[model samples]
Target: MTTERREPDRNADERTMLEGWLDYHRCTLARKCEGLTDEQVRTASVEPSVLSLMGLVRHMAEVERAWFRRVLVDDDAGWIYCSEADPDGEFRLTDADTWQEAQATWQAEIDIARRNAAGFALGDLSRGRSGSGGEPFSLRWIYTHMIEEYARHNGHADLIRERLDGATGD
Candidate 1:
């Protein structure tokens, strides 16, 4: 099978530093979903879990939109995957429709996330509206949270991808 390759990094800075870390986990997760057929992407290797690679892609799409667009940007376009009727539905199997559709959604989310992040300054870290009205958090906290979330999922993706195929590491 053909493996997709990533380019080498050139230089480093505050922006690149954050992006490098983000890209590391992002590409790792993307690699986990690579080299699989559409059927494989949709297949639930873990029975009764609905946790397919396609599903993860879709879920992360919603996650990026919700966190960066809705929450951080104050767009108020509403949560992508969560609502009163379907709370925690982000992980649920909805309608990724097809492999291409899922990938497009994921790409869109990533693009928007990159754009949103670019608008911020490196040292700028402040909170906006609180969902619970309990307390406030810094933008730095949000960035760190996003990184942590991706890192955790990348680990899971590594194991899942390994089970799906013998592929490992970049």
Candidate 2:
């Protein structure tokens, strides 16, 4: 697993600090999936949920792509890892039948998200992007929302992975 050092930018403001925190949490979530076997990765302690470590990786990948690449960047791009046929199908097990496949998908999505995030300025919150809402939302709100979503899920992942194996943090 790779860890990036956090550096404070003299020019950065509060939003940049918050974004850095968000990025750290996201990276941590991805790291949780590292150094595990295929069977261990797919093992689910909770029945009916199928919320395996690999599943979380796939789900979070979809999230990064959906939020950063699709919603925040381009609205016209087709949804990644999402479909109307099965709304929550990204979590469903499919041909990611192997551990390698799951890891590849997760890494690919994370790479794309990091690349997209690198392009945006911390203060670039002027555009109002509206979802299934009555009004639009600022970029600040979107960044915060993504951070919250990842942090919440990472907590769940921590427990799930611990249950699956004795593995813990990076």
Candidate 3:
């Protein structure tokens, strides 16, 4: 499946530019996983590294939930595929985990994230703290952080995809 990733408007406002770049990175990730089998997506990047395409998707879902629902919206909604007992659980695939399910969950989180972000201005501070006992973060900070997070992970996705099938490029 081809992902319709658009370039950020060069002349757009800060908010629009940020949102566009974030969405572009998001689609880049999805495009990286296109045409892969479930088994392929589940395949680890390399020895001693548990990272996989599907794992990235799952991890991003948790990130979206944490920043948007838990932080921005200040909702009590918790991690979708992780827990305090297994903080990195999303990166560890189970036999039952499928790409379809992971993609659906990730898309759902993205939807919630968009809605939550829309309610706040870029300069608005979050109701929730940054981390355990940390200070509250502004929407602007969250946006910048999220874009950076996705950009870094998308780099990993590129390598994972190329390793899996010689496919490359955003």
Candidate 4:
């Protein structure tokens, strides 16, 4: 992949720090899919689990769209994949899903997420549901959550990638 993952600076402001870390995790996920074919990426490493590198990409795209477009932006932008009919569609990758298209959509959602967050301050309240009282969530909270989400999925990607070709690293 062309994108290079960078480390977050310690001396940066909170917003920059959060964004940097989030970006780092995002790149980590992308790195796991680098140099892999569509069929290889579609292979599930663990039995009884639909986990795969491409599935993770698709899932992250849905996450970005949900949090940034529908929640953060307070727009009624519909879901990306998961729905009543196919609740786990994001993780259900087949030979039909080319790596290029999945990667493009994921990257695009990340860009949109950045744009949505740019228009708000860290403390800015999102219309999305909060932890309690049905209150709005903060941009900072959303950023932190997104970072955690990527970190967890990146771990899964690591296992799947290693099993796929014996390749491993951050």
Candidate 5:
């Protein structure tokens, strides 16, 4: 499916603006993966680098679950594709990994993130601490961090897509 990404409103309130940009970046990632074969989606940007469109989807899914469910709602949402033993498991795809599965999982996590964030104000503090020992994160902080995370990864995605098929966009 084609991703429909909208520009974040310039005059929106703080929360609205943050959510807008986050959704934009989310759709940007999805757009990057569109029209590619499963193998193409799983292809790494470079040798020895596990980063791929599929891997980014999986990694973002993990990030969404971590920041929204585990930290925000204290839901004990364990990693879906990663673990304590292999923190980067999402990027290390196996033969079983597929674009459809990774996309669905990432979208599911995004849905959960929206629901969890809806119950709290932007200033609300997380129920859990960051990285097992860091300070509690405010919803504001999480939103900001998520945007930055996506922005950086989306840059990687842009280059990957260009390398794979000469596709490029905002």
Candidate 6:
């Protein structure tokens, strides 16, 4: 079980502060799934929704790969989990999907993302394509979007955990 040890500085520069807070949220998400069984991680929040700890982890891996490898690094390996054939595959957890593998994959993506974004400044533009042919973005935007993505999913994790075993936290 992973424990929470993320502590962000109250004061820092833009990059430092954003990275600290983003790491805090990342650790927070990992903490939300601590000590859970494979089946437990796959348990959906409600009957109608596809929300689960495993699904969230998988989705984050997809996000990390897309933003870092495809968008940031200009690679073509897009959508790690979902696809046009199975767009919701990340949330489609089965007994074959182990938590150990999920954690490792997510961690690997996180590492790649960190490395890919390391060379760029906050104001650097993205080289990825867009609807209008191509539109650039700041590294700051990527960092902030990552924070928001984790924050949203972490909230879902909180609800799912609470529903699973009455566990709760900030």
The Cα local distance difference test for each model comes to 0.70, 0.70, 0.92, 0.88, 0.92, 0.84
Q: Clash number for model 5?
A: 0
As for model 2, its CA RMSD to the true structure in angstroms is: 3.2
Global lDDT of model 3: 0.92
TM-score of 3: 0.96
Query: Residue 155 error for model 5, in Å?
Result: 0.5
Tell me the tens digit of each residue's lDDT in model 4 across 34-101: 88888888988789998889899999999999888777878777777688899889998765778888
Off by over 4 Å in 4: 128-132
TM-score-best of 2 and 4:
4
| Model 2 TM | 0.78
Using TM-score as the measure, the top candidate is 3
How high is the lDDT of residue 69 in model 3? 89
Per-residue lDDT over 1-170 for candidate 6, one digit per residue giving the tens place of the 0 to 100 score: 56655667767888888888888888888998898888889898898988899999999999888877777767787676788999989998876888899999999998988888888888887766432556766788889999999899899999999998899887
Q: Tens digits of per-residue lDDT for model 1 on 47-88?
A: 777677777777778777777777667666566556899765
lDDT of 2 by residue, 28-52 (tens): 7766766777777787758878778
TM-score of 4: 0.94
Write one digit per residue (lDDT tens) for candidate 5, span 10-50: 99999999999999999999999999999999999999898
User: What's model 4's lDDT at 42?
Assistant: 90
Instruction: State the weakest 10-residue window (summed lDDT) of model 5.
Output: 127-136
Quote the positional error of residue 88 for candidate 6 in Å.
1.6
Q: Which scores higher on lDDT, 2 or 5?
A: 5
Summing lDDT over every window of 10 consecutive residues in candidate 1, give the lowest-scoring window.
1-10
* Model 1 pairs whose backbones collide: none
Better of 4 and 5 by lDDT: 5
lDDT tens digits, residue span 91-130, model 3: 9999988899999999999998999999999999898646
